[model samples]
Target: MLFDKIARPAMYRLAYHDPEVVHERTVRLLGRVAPALGPVSRVYRTDDPVTVLGLRFPNRVGLAAGMDKNGLALKAWPALGFGFVEVGTVTRHAQPGNPKPRLFSLPGSDGVINRMGFNNDGAEALARRLAAHGKPGVPLGISIGKSKVTPLDEAVEDYRFSLRALHPYADYFAINVSSPNTPGLRALQDKAALAELLAELGRTSAELGGSTPLLVKVAPDLTEEALAELVEVCLGHGVAGIIATNTTLSREGIAPADAHLAAEIGGLSGRPLAARSLEVVKFVHECTEGKLPIIGVGGILGPDDARRMLDAGASLVQLYTGFALHGPGLVRRVSRGIAGRPC
Candidate 1:
């Protein structure tokens, strides 16, 4: 009640409602308060633990990638009740992202559009940061993406570097070929490209003692045939799991009041994405015959959305836009709501 009525309004009003500015401020603030989050953890953390990809999650809810691209608030997230936290979408090289105003919020539509272009301080920096702070108490999944300066053909080596650099820190690695911001990044999802990439990463994972799991984050724009083929490729290459439905490019469900914001170029995420994300999760579960675990994300703003994703056969669910719009209260609500449900 306080967040929806008071805090959120104040946050949205910050910097004349620029989403990225608000995001930067929030992450910075979280990092400062991290050490004092023990009480927050006691209040919000739920104890319905489940094991997926050989990692034990305190609950089914996890902080999705893009929220903390460089893992700035590592300790703060688990304390705020995320069963686990997936950080990054970080690239191998440090690159300034697209430009200012790349991230936009759609309050009317309960969504967000961002073309953040794999912005981060490079993988080696993140590795050093993690080595210094050590891993958070909960399972940590590092999302690796190709650097913008790296040519498409060289994506495998680019991703390989990040995998090798962060191997010791990650409980799992989410291979991000799905974000719409980077030029031609989604092409990595093509069968041959994905197969080659996964094959090499599988080799790298094995070389790194083969413990950390590798999963793919896919685009919501894919057709059923493309999605099924992607699943087959993942399975063939020993991929451990799939993160269904990253943000979307289509502006199909933006409300009339927010239709003007639909012109923004980037992926769309929030209530508008719920139906398709759920459909994709169900399809992947059926296609894989439940042989592969899924960490469902996209449009999960409330307990009902999380519950639906689990019912659609996700072993776990994650939050990105939902957390951004609804705040940490949403995490507590979701963690508490889903506790005790079967994984």
Candidate 2:
């Protein structure tokens, strides 16, 4: 209540509504206070444990990739009751990413539009940070993407480099080929391209002792045919799971007051994304006949949204824009909701 009523509002107002500013400040604060967050663990943690991809999750809800891109506050996420924390969309090389004013907040519609690209300190930096910080209590998923400077054809090697750098620390690797912000990134989702990518990743994972689970994050804009083909490729290539539906390129559900922001270029995430994401999860589930595990994401803003994702055959779910807007209270609510405990 205090976070939604006061802190959230104040954070939104910071730096004249520059979303990245609030994001940076929040991550830094969480890192600083992580050591003293025992009370947070006690109050927010919900235990409805399950094992997926050979990794045990303390709950169904997890902090999604791109939220803590560099693993800055690794310790604080478990304290906040997330079943797991996925960090990075980090690439092989460090680059500044797009330009300033690249992230927009749509409060009225409960959405965010970002073309931030795959901005990060690179996988090597993240590997060092994880090493120094030690692993967090919850499972860690590292999302890797091709460097902006890397050509489309060479994407496999770029992603492979990061996987090698971070392999020892991650519980899983989410091959990020669907973020719309990076030019030519989503093209890698095509059947042939994805097949090549996953094949190389499989061999590389084998070289690294073959223990880390590899999953793919997909876009919400794919057609049913495209999605079906993608699933077939995943099944054929030995991919462990799929994170159904990353942010969407559509602007159909924005509020009237925020109509102008809808014209912004980038993937859209939040409430407007709920229906499409759910549909994709259901489609993937039915298409695979429940053989493949799915980490459902996008548009999960509350407990009901999380519940619906689970009902749609998602083995697990993750939070991004929802946690950004609602704070840790939302985590506790969704955790308790999934565990059948009263919130």
Candidate 3:
């Protein structure tokens, strides 16, 4: 209610600019303000113990990645109340991402479009912080992607390097073969490439031991046939979880009058994504014949949307654009809603 009445009006004024800059400023501002909230922040924390993919999640609401790729504000998040935080789409090596205006907001439509191209200080930088900080009160999931400059054929090695580097710090490792912004990244999800990538990661993770869960984040725009094949691969590779989606390349649901410069390029997120993500989750659930569990993503802004995904059969849910627009209060609302629903 506070965001609907107070914050939404304030954010509308800045919706015209580039998204990455807006994101950086928002994180810094939240870090400063989060520390002062006191017990108000605790409303987002839930003590329920959930063991998924071999890790004990304090709760099911995870802060989706691309929010803190470098883990810069690691210490501040737990205090602000996130059940878990998935940081980074950190690449194998650091490189400046797509030039400028890579991020955009479509406030009139309650969505955002980002072509961030996986910009980060790379896996090593994130691993150092995670190793130093250990893990959060909730489990920490690290999302790793292939570097932009890395050629398509070498995708496996690129993801492997990041996996080995982040192994110790991650409670679960998310193989981000999804994300539309990276040129050939999504191609890796194709049968031949995806099979090799997951097979190799599975072998290496097993050698490392310790049982950290492995999840594959996928795109909602995929064809039904493609999704079926992906689910088959996931089951074969021992995937412990499926992050039902990443932001979408589809622009169908957003109100045309309000779509921004980002509307021209990049993946769409927020309310526009809700229905499609629910469909994807339902599809994955059905294909697995109710076997593989999913962590639903896309267009979630409040408890109702969160509940919709759960009703569609997601085991857990995550937010990126919703959390950005509504502040920590959104997490609190969603977390409280999740806790109330009997699992």
Candidate 4:
């Protein structure tokens, strides 16, 4: 208990570097030791079971994508007691993400900003990892996006290629059109493009003859009108669920003094995202009239943030920044907070 109490803060301090650097170090170190994660690592593992999107979740809290971009820590992450893990915003072609200083921290505000721009090792490598890694006894969500240099015109094809490469490995797939770092990526979020892309992907997934769930991860920057249209598009195309927010470009509610790296060219996540994410979740819930499942994300620092999302209409929630700040204990805390609460 004493170790856990002191360790989270220190680990968080060490992690406040560039996202890509932190990411690479984590993969190298954990990848070396992950295989040694035996019974002792089960300290935070939870037994609570949840069924969402026709998939069984070991718990309700998940580690959102961008944390384990290559699916490198698949075996180890679940040991952290996360009910689910979303890895990658993988593209069809591997590319180095945005140049350094791509991640920044606002230590005072407990937030982070990153323009890492999807620096993944590509879909095929991730597919290989997924194929090689043992199952974590929980569902895994694989998020895919367009390559950095991919033109808007062929974005669908890029996604299609990635989908094909990653289909076998992902239990569920999240179409990520919301990341702010990628140029013209949000254009896919437009009604017509979204409809055409998703319809085709839906058909393709159907042809695979497996029960893979499909989710769309939306941006927090979207206005009510835009969100409503996206909701309509999702429902019409039979989207299985919506990850109610990626990061935001908004700096509202943040004092200039506290905005350590607010000007950083990336999406802002953590405390700054709490209010808008809840609002987006609520909008998606009411707009769908509760038919669609929304995975609440952004902020989600502690039980209160998790509870806010659930109460506002999230079926489940994912956290990256929060997990970094507070550590794996959050999964148990949030699960205990939500257990037997409601659907």
Q: What TM-scores do the predictions have?
A: 0.98, 0.98, 0.93, 0.94
lDDT of 2 by residue, 1-343 (tens): 7889999988888735588989988999999999999987999999998888998888889999988898899999999999999998899998888998888889898888989898899999999998887989889999999999999999999999999999999999999999998899999999999999999999999999999999999899999899999999999999999998899999989999789898889989999999999999999999999999999998998889988998998999999999999899999998888884221
Q: Residue 186 of model 1: what lDDT?
A: 96
lDDT of 3 at 131: 76
Lowest lDDT 10-mer window, candidate 2?
334-343
Model 4 CA lDDT for position 136: 55
Higher-scoring candidate on lDDT, 3 or 4: 4
Number of backbone-clashing residue pairs for each candidate, in the order shown: 0, 0, 2, 0
Candidate 4 C-alpha error for residue 331, in Å: 2.3
lDDT, residue 283, candidate 3: 91
lDDT (tens digit, per residue) of candidate 3 on 201-223: 99889888848788999999899
Compared with the true structure, what per-residue lDDT tens digits does model 1 show for residues 173-269?
A: 9999999999999999999999999999999889989988999999989999999999999999989999998999989789998898899898899
Model 3: per-residue Cα lDDT at residue 143: 95
Report, for every candidate in turn, its global Cα lDDT versus the true structure.
0.91, 0.91, 0.82, 0.84
Model 4 lDDT tens row, 127-214: 8877777555578899999998988998988988999998887889999999999999999999999999999898888888657889
Candidate 1 error regions (>4 Å):
none
Q: Which stretches of candidate 4 lie over 4 Å from their true place?
A: 1-20, 255-257
Clashes of 3: 2
RMSD (Cα, Å) of candidate 1? 0.9
